[model samples]
Target: MTSVTSLPASEQEGARTSPEDPEKLEDPEKATLSTDPSETSLPNNKRVEQPTKINWLLTCVGLYLGALLYGLDTTVAATVQASVYEELGNLQKLPWVGIGFPLGSVAVILLIGKLYDTFEIKWLIIGSVTLFEAGSALCGAAPTSNALIVGRVIAGMGGAGMYIGALNYISIFTTSMQRPIYNALIGLCWGTGAILGPVVGGAFSDSSAKWRWAFYINLPLAAVVSPLYFLNFPRYNPQPEHTALEKFKQIDWLGAFLNASTFVLFILILSFQGPIWRWAAPGSIVLWVLFGLSLISYGLQQTFSILTSPERRLFPIDFLARRTLLLMFFATSSAAAATSVTLYYVPLFFQFTKGDNALEACVRLLPFIVPFVFFVMFSGGLLPVVERYAPWYFPAGVLMIVGGALMYKVSPNTYTAAIYGFEILIAIGTGLVFQTGYAVVAAKVPAHRVAASIGFINIAQIGSICITLAIAGSIFGNLGFVKLEHVLTGYGFTDSELRSALAGSFSPVFQHGDARARKLAIEAVVSTMGTSFALVFVAGAVTLVSAFCMRWEKLGLQTTAGG
Candidate 1:
């Protein structure tokens, strides 16, 4: 260097630096500096860091809060439906209030989950939350039943996106070590929502507040969370090398369409079967046919996607093939069906049989909700101690079966303690199985597809609920008040008197009657409702059978230290 030897082409330009330059190459500090622009322009790995631990914690808290809102929205409408129906003066349309939210939410869950996979989730969350608040506001202001239904439908869209997005985000953000806690948090949110829905609805309805306040309450919560979410949540910018169009092309839109159609048609058909259309009606038959065709189309599309894709499709056939996932689906579906059946009939029983008002009816249901919350928390703790889920699964099935059988035994004169005990059995069964099923599915499926799997499981669950509710409603309708009145005519009660008494509810048939007449009428109602419980028992038995089909080892039979 001192001899001034010729430099390479690249270095020659730098060596001939002008005197105007800040420093000469002979300077030690200057010599150490990188003259190459590329070297100096390179990104600093240490300087450009990822989100801090505090940011992650905040994100999780936000997601958990979002999940709570999602679950609460699903059932809160149910508690206020009676009031809504009474105000609207259409008891026939009452079921729609409960059905609309779940149907709409279930319809979009898988699609939304897949969208999250293909696109940025943060925007979807923002849009969903905004939609939720708007819907809530609209519902609060609605003057007609149709307007309220529209609001509910809009809210359901938001709920579907929020729920699926939360699950997807949690799955991606949490490590295996954190999954147990993360999943437990989700379970807690759902459980809490289920518990609070009745209480909130009852309180609002019982007070001077209109039933509309139930929908309105969501707005303030949404406003508070939205800004915090926008500020603190990390922006997920996809690498620019891949354009948005290319990403969009990768989504299976056809699959989405078919899946939505299938659910819509299926739910519509199920809804029509009870009072809208007789079981054997031609319109019902056509709906069933349409539902079948849609299902077939959905399956074919999925199959084609799997066969034709260059990369593995989002829904791999192998995931569905997993025995653990299948069993978990059945377990969840049956448990959900049981819960739906209980919720549908219990209030009616309290109102009619027990002569309880709306608030009192809801309070009477505490036996189910209280035990459910307790068992859910208790099971989260016990999961770490138990090595296998099979033990829990078996007991859960037994409890459900026993509960259904005992509930079938309830009569006009049945002791309050017995009724509470039966409710406890149902609650324990539901709580034990629900979280365990999710755990099993998560264990069997790839981590990335957990949201999709959950969506599918929830679809099955909602499907079961819809079908069971329809069947129960059909049974109730078929056993008309007129028929019941005629049956009670020979009990020293005139036809006019019987009609007036039975007009309000099926309860007077059970209570405030001659001993022999009460016994017969109660027997008749029980025998009729027994058919519904029999279906529940059958569902429980199927769950038990499916439990044995799950591969224990594959389902993480070796429990984690903190599961």
Candidate 2:
């Protein structure tokens, strides 16, 4: 027991004050008091207050639920896109549902991360969850593709906040020894969500009574979790208060704007090519120029902010200066890119090559779902017991490369078991990297900046997803579909029938085609997918680069200068 009055002001405020703050009660001639309580006995009645024990089980459950919602929104839309397009009457705009969510998410994540740093996380959680639910409702009721895209954008903002906020809270509540397990649980949430989203979406779409129920599903879950989040999550208020104007000044709104502009330009270039515009179209050139300029502007802004006001900038120079942080950023980005490409193409293969409907395709992809769930939970449980996490990255990277290579060999006649095996490899690889990367970032950065750092990492992940998906879509549209359709017309299929078949995905082509035409279409499909799989190899190379960036020893127990 130690009495408050006996301790100096410095010691009294040790946990609260920044290290850079002046020692207000220092006496120049006196020696500093020892932090050890054994030096002086305290009054029997006085005792130090220990921190409250967090409801770990509930927090984990809540985070899992939040992550599940995010995965559901992202993946479920892909399977249901044809169904939605049938009702919405805009086949050309179908890609918007996928592109909009990640685009909106990447734009706000950096700013929201800074907000998490400067304000209480309680408000962020509350606001984001509320907005997400509202967006869900809007999406469920959407009458057109445009309205659904808008709702998804709103939902994306909320999802970004939840992702950053949950990771931040998990870091706050857990000790170093406990952090790996918690991080792993976050990965588990993602894997579970990925597994559930397609199944749920496909089932609802197949029922046809209410395809909109997929969006409505999030409402009840959110209602149950909101109150628990409010009650159990700790509050994080900033010590130095600033006005709304000052707070706005702190955020790099220009950076956010540039980021969004870059993504939109890239997506437009990818999705519109050959569909609405030629490859060498003036619009494509204009978008490419805009993207390049936006990127340059963003880089300059970040550099200038660091140089001019290193101390006050939202992304402090210290966080970026660390090699580990840089490595983790690249690692997470590559890993995200890899996962998105795999998820994007798997269903495409099923739809085109195997001639399966969305519901049947989802069921066929269970190999992916089963492995992801098992490996994620297993990894989460094992992280606490393991002494070193760095070695795990190698296996993860290898599995990813292997999976991508297997996918490169996929043909219309290839056995379903082979595809399942490849998917399993992908699932394991993704599980290995997802949580491990977060753990490394958290471990390397200071406690106070954990939320902000994790926020940046989340941005990198979503940003990579947006960029990769756009790239994949571009490749698929340009190389696969356009050529296949031309080849089909040469085989004497009528314009209307060919248009109808291509409009609904490649499945309908197999149903109506002669044996020779079907063979050629399958070969073209395989060649197209092989090109996409080549992109995964690039992702694997990026993973190796990420591995080179991690410095395990350097990351241990270091504080940022401002702390």
Please name the candidate that would achieve the greatest TM-score relative to the true structure: 2
Residue 184, model 2: Cα distance from true site in angstroms? 1.3
RMSD of each: 13.3, 7.0
Worst 10 residues of 1 by lDDT: 40-49
> Candidate 1: misplaced stretches above 4 Å?
1-51, 235-241, 306-317, 384-387, 479-530, 554-563
Candidate 2 ranges with C-alpha deviation above 4 Å: 1-56, 243-246, 306-308, 312-321, 492-519, 552-563
List the pairs of residues colliding in candidate 1: none
lDDT of 2 by residue, 471-514 (tens): 87677656776557767767766543443444355345667778
Per-residue C-alpha lDDT of model 1 across residues 1-563, encoded as one tens digit per residue: 01212223343222222224535422311221122321211111211113456666676677778778766766676468767865774455555666666777766766676676656667878888888778778888988887887787788778777777776665544433345456667777776775566557766766799688888998888777776577665444322245789877777777767777887787677556644677789999999999999889778778777433623243444446556667777888888778776765565566556667666776777898887877776665565446366777787788888898887767666777787788888888877776666555544443334555666665666556656665665555456434556567666665433433322333344446776776555455545555566656766787778777755542222223321
Q: For model 2, which pairs clash? A: none
